[model samples]
Target: MIVRGVRGATTVKANQEKEILDATEGLMRTICEENEIDPENVAQVILTVTEDLTATFPAKALRRLAGWTHVPVMCAQEIPVPNGLEKCIRVMITLNTTKAQSEIHHVYLNEAVKLRPDLQLTKDS
Candidate 1:
């Protein structure tokens, strides 16, 4: 099995801790479910948040999930670019999988759907 990176992003309603955590958790769960990923097979997860979100680290949310305590998770601040989406959280999960890159599902939820409309699983207004 080769190591592959699964990407996902979501927007939070606010910069509160709970909002960030909830959004991160939801996004991660969707990515795992859609890709059928095993937590044990996940090598590491890197989370990034937009400058507008500073209430908490996205990795903190993963700790609340089962079997994720042992996973290597890191959090960083996303570069603030002109007209970049706000209150956004992004994750890149490195995992061992036999599936090809094209077979992997990348999740984009809420207003983040605008970030990658092609990968959005649900219709967004």
Candidate 2:
């Protein structure tokens, strides 16, 4: 199976540790569910938070998932671009899967939906 990347993003109301962790966990769960990803097949997870979100590293939340201990997870600060969304957390998961790239689901939650309206999850999704 070829490796595929699943992208997801969400925004937190504040920079608190709880808010960041909750939002990251929610986003990770949605991405796995939507894409039918197996945690064991996950090669790596890279998490990024916008400049305004400095309360904690988003990658810390992924540790709460089962079978993620061996997965290589990294966290970094997002580049401060003009007009960028604030208090946002993004995750890109690399996994081994047979699914085609077009069939992969990208999740965007909260205000992050504005970042990619085309990939927005609808009520029926």
Candidate 2 stretches with Cα past 4 Å from truth are 120-125
For each candidate, the alpha-carbon lDDT, in order, equals: 0.88, 0.88
- What are the TM-scores, per candidate, against the unseen true structure? 0.94, 0.94
lDDT of 1 by residue, 1-125 (tens): 99999988889888899988988888888888999998999999999999999888889999999889999999998998999998999899999999998898888888888888766364232
Q: Write the per-residue lDDT of candidate 2 for residues 1-125, one digit (tens) a residue.
A: 99999998899899899999998988888888889888999999999999999888888888898877788999999999999899999899999999998899999888888888876462121
**Candidate 1 off by > 4 Å:** 120-125
Error of 1 at 98 (Å): 0.8
Give the Å error, residue 33, model 1. 0.5
Task: For model 2, state the Cα shift of residue 99 in Å.
Answer: 0.4
Q: All predictions: root-mean-square deviation over Cα?
A: 1.6, 2.0
